[model samples]
Every structure is written in C-alpha cells, then in structure tokens.
Target: MMRVLLAVLFVSAGVMHFVIEPTFTAMVPPFLPAPRVLVWISGVAEIALGLATLAPRLRPYAGWGLVALLIAVFPANVYMVFDDTPAIDAPRWALWARLPIQALLVGWAIWATEATKLVRR
Candidate 1:
C-alpha cells in the first residue's frame, strides 16, 4: 500500500541520518545554530512520524507532520544547491531535482493518509 511505502521510505531515511551523519550535518544551512543537534532531532522526528503513519488514528497527524518537516527542511536542500562549496558530491542537477521532489513527497503524505478528508470534517 502507498501508506506502508511512505512509512518505509521515511524510516529508512531517518536511519540514514545517523548512518551518514556528516552529509546531513553539512546540509544544514549556515544560519542555523547547532547543526549536529538539529540533525539528530530531525532524525528522531522522522522515525516517530514514519511509524505514526501506520496507526489509523495517527496517520492524519503524521501526514501533516511530514508536510511540516518537508517544508522545514527545504532551506537545507536549497543550501546544498547554492552553497559556495557543495555539501555533498552530488551533481548540480541531482541537487536541483530534490527541490521538486520535496513537493512530491508532501503530496504523497497527503494522498497516502487522506489528511485533507480529515480537514473536511
């Protein structure tokens, strides 16, 4: 199911935060203080929200949380693309691709959890 798939994607990404800490830490925008702490906190949030999506009662909140998380991290994606020295070794095009991909992920969370339906009630 799409919900399960989304959960897996997020959970995997959350785990990767710790597995490749440096890459994520580097992705933090310069204006932010304590990049390492922020990375760890976001990782925990991702894992929690990802698992929350599995519970029917929690799915809507999880979906909204994902949307917020995606938006919160948007600046980092931009930083990676525009920073004087690239954060990672990724190609410029690939970095650019991530911007739109964030929108897709937001849409996916909405569709997978039917969060909009909850709003209608």
Candidate 2:
C-alpha cells in the first residue's frame, strides 16, 4: 500500500509539473541551460519511473531511480529556499525546512519498494 501511494504521488507530481509549468520554471537555477527543457524532461521521466515502480519486478530499480531523482533535483530545492519569491509563496522557514525532508523522501522510496532488501542480500 505504501508503494501504491508513492507511485500515485509520483504520477500526480509528474502531471503537476506540466500543470504548473511556470512555477516549475521558476524553480530552475539560472546556471542551468534550457530550464524549460529540463522541466519537461524531469516531468516525463517522473511519469515513466513512477509507472515502473508499480510492477513487482521493477520496483527496486524504480525505487533507486526515484532516490536518484530526488538527489538530482535537490539543488533546485536549495535555490528555491533563497529565492526572494518562490512561486508557491512558502514562508522562508518552510523553504529552508524542506531540505531535510528530502532525506525522509529518499528513505520512504527505499522502504516502499523494499530497495534496502536488495542491497542487504
């Protein structure tokens, strides 16, 4: 059931990437080239990866992929923290607060798909 919820969360988040394009665009760090391109690419990848997590055989790989995804996109999360006006209008502390939450997200992805079991064996 946790896996199901995480999969659904990814799918919804992936779709929201497009639905909230401007906001996503705003999150991109200025140093990166083609922010729009990266936004779309990440969205599509999220959808594919999210669906892959639904299959019993694919869950482990997809779970690790999500772990990577979270790490890869973390810089933007950091950037959003310092931005004078983050698109979501989150309070300053909330922006800073989200950083540690990423670790929890990584842990949840691992547990939901039982990725740790793969590593332990």
Candidate 3:
C-alpha cells in the first residue's frame, strides 16, 4: 500500500543517516550549528515518525511531522544547489531536483496519512 511505501521510504532514509553519516551531515546548511548533532536528531525523528505512520491513531500526527521535517530541511536542499562548494558530489541538476521532490514527499505524507481530514475539522 501507499502508506507502507511511505513508511518504508522514511525509515530507510532515517537509517541511511547513520549508515552514511558523512553524506547526511554534509547536507546540513553551513549556518546551522552542530551539523552532526542535527543530522542525528533528524534521523531519529524520521524513524519515529515513519513507524508512527503505521498506527492508525498516529498516522495523522506522523503526516504533519513529516511535513514540518521536510520544510525544516529545505534550506539544505537549496544550499546544495547554490553553494559554491557543495559538500556532496551530486550534479547540479540532481540537487535542484530534490527541491520539488521535497514538495511531493510532503504531499504524499499528507495524502497517505489522511492529514487533510484533520485540517478540515
């Protein structure tokens, strides 16, 4: 199901933070203090929210959390595209693509967990 897929996506991404620590840490914007710490915290949050999405009662909250997380990390995506010396070795177009993908992920989290219904009430 789409919900399961979303959960897997997030959970896998979270695990990758630790598996590829340097890569994720590199994505942190230069302005942020303690980039490694921030990466760790966000990884844990992603894992928790991903698992929470599996519980019907928790799905809505997880959805909103994902939206917030996506927004919060957006600056890094922007930085990747614009920074003169990007930490990651990705191509410029690939980095640029991540921006819109973030939006799609937000929309997916909302739709998969039915977060909009909560907003309607």
Candidate 4:
C-alpha cells in the first residue's frame, strides 16, 4: 500500500539525516550564509517529517506536512544547482535533476496518502 511505502520512505530518510549529517550539511543552500545551523535544522525537519508520515490516523496531517516540508527544502536543491554547492561527486546535471525528482516524490506521497482525488469521471 502507498501508506506503508510512504511511512517506510520517511523513516528511512529520517535515519539518513542523522546518519549522514556531514554529507547533508555539504548540500545546504549557499545563500543562507550560515551552513551549520541551517543544515542541523534541515536534518531535524527531515527526521520529523519522516516520522510524522507513518501513522494511519495522521496520514492526512502528514500529507500536508510533507507538502510543506517539500516546499521548505526546495531552497537547498536550488542552492545546489545555482550556488555552486558541491554535489558530492554527482555530475552537475544529475544534481540539478534533484529538483524535479523531489516533485515526483511529493506526488508519490500525495497519492499514497490519497489526500486528493486523482481520477475524475
């Protein structure tokens, strides 16, 4: 089920935030001017969002939470592409591809949550 998948995805990503803090820090938005605090906060937010998306009763709330979370994190992707932030060995375009890929993940979360109607007859 989509719910299960979303839950697992969130939990896994949450774990990564803590596990790979340094790599994550390296991806912070360059325009932010402060890297450490921003990276820490972003990591925390990812953990929170990942955990929040797991409960059945909270799926709707988590759905919206994910939407907000995605929007909030968009800046980091933008910074990665535009600000010359290191891509952790990824090619420049693959790094840029993250922006749209994020949208796909968000869409997957929405579908998994079934928060909105997708099929119109």
Candidate 5:
C-alpha cells in the first residue's frame, strides 16, 4: 500500500540522516551560523518524522509535521543548488528538482496518512 511505502520511505530517509550526515552538513544554509548544529537538529527531526509516520495514531500529525518540516528546511535545499554543494553529487538540475519534489512528498504524506484513516480524534 501507498501508506506502507511512505512509512518505509520516511524510515529510510530518517535513518539516512545519520548515514549521510556529512553530505547533509554540506547542504546547510549559509545564513545559518552553525551548520553542524542545524544538521543534527534536522537529523533528529527526520528520525522523529519517520517514527511518527509509522504510528497509526500519530500518522496525521506526522503528515502535517512533515509538510511543515519540509517547508522549514527548504532553505537548505535552495542553498545546495545556489551554492553548488559538491557534497550532494548531483547535477544542477537535479538539485533544483529537489524543491518541488519535496512539496510532492508533503502531499504524499498527507494522502498516505488520510487514506489509511489514521487521524486521531
């Protein structure tokens, strides 16, 4: 099911934060004075998102949380394209592609959570 897939994706992406810490650190926004701290925070958020998405009672909150988180962290995505972070290992367009795809992820998370009828009362 799509919900299962989204949950798995979130889990995998959350786990990847630790696995790809250095690369994520490189994508941190220039305006942020402490890139390393932000990276860690994002990692923690991602892990929380992943876990939240898996909990039926928490899925709707997780879905909306992910949407907000994606919007909040979008600056990093922009910086990666703008600053040309070599650590990402992607083409210029690929970097640009990440932005809208993130929005799509927000939609996906919402639909997945709703389709499962997991929203708490």
Candidate 6:
C-alpha cells in the first residue's frame, strides 16, 4: 500500500543520507551553518518519521512531520538547481523538476498517512 511505500522511501533516503553524506552535504546552501550537523539531523528525522508512519496512531503526526521536513529541505533542492553540483550529476531538467516533485511527495505522504487533505492552489 501507499503507506508501506512511503516508509521504504523515507527509510532508504535516510540511510542514503549517511551512506552518501558528502553528496547531501554539498546540497546545503552556504547560508546554512554546519552542513554536517544538518545532514545528520535530517537523516535522523527521516528515519524517525519513516518508522513513526508505520504506527496507525502516529500516522497523522508523521505525515505532518514529513510535510515539514520536505519544506525544510527544499532550499537544498534549490541550491542544487542553481549550483548544478557535479556531486549529484542529475540532469538539468530533473534537477528543476524536483521542485514540483516535492509537492507531489507531500501529497503522497498525506494520502498515505490519511492526514488532512491538501488543497491544490
């Protein structure tokens, strides 16, 4: 089901955060302090949210937390697009496309967790 997929996605991403720490660290905008700290914290949050989403009673909170997490990490996505860092090596279109993809992910989390509906603007 959607819930299971979300859990896997988050868990895998969380693990990758550690496995490929430098790649993620490069995405952090220069304005942000302590890239290593942010990367580790984000990874931990992803793992926690992924596990929490599995619990029916905690699904709502986990979903909202994911939404916040996605929003919080968005600047890194932006930084990637502009910097076009060779570290990730993603195609230009794919890099730009990640913006809307984040919204879609937020919607997916809401649907999977049965949280409040996301109204399209």
The Cα RMSD of model 4 versus the native structure comes to 3.6
In order of TM-score, best first, we have 1, 3, 6, 2, 5, 4
Using Cα atoms with residue i matched to residue i, what is each candidate's TM-score against the true structure?
0.95, 0.92, 0.94, 0.78, 0.86, 0.93
Candidate 1 achieves a global lDDT of: 0.92
Candidate number with greatest TM-score? 1
Give the Cα error of residue 44 in candidate 3, in Å.
0.5
Compose the digit string of candidate 6's lDDT tens values, residues 1-121: 8899999999899989999999999999999999999999999999999989999888888999999999999999999889967788889899899999999999999889877733331
On the 0 to 100 scale, the lDDT of residue 49 in model 1 is 93
Clash number for every model? 0, 0, 0, 0, 0, 0
lDDT of 1 by residue, 6-40 (tens): 99999989998999999999999989999999999
Better of 1 and 5 by lDDT: 1
Candidate 1 residue pairs that clash: none
Q: Which candidate model has the greater lDDT, 2 or 4?
A: 2
C-alpha displacement of 3 in model 6, angstroms? 0.5
Best candidate, lDDT: 1
Backbone clashes counted, model 5: 0
Tens digits of lDDT, candidate 5, 1-121 = 8877886776777677788888888988877878877777777777787678778878788888777888888998888888966788989998889989998998897887773354444
The residue-by-residue lDDT of candidate 4 on 82-115, one tens digit each, is 6554536677898789999989988977777765
- Deviating ranges (above 4 Å) for candidate 6: 117-121
- So what's the TM-score on candidate 2? 0.92
Better of 2 and 6 by TM-score: 6
For model 4, the local distance difference test gives 0.71
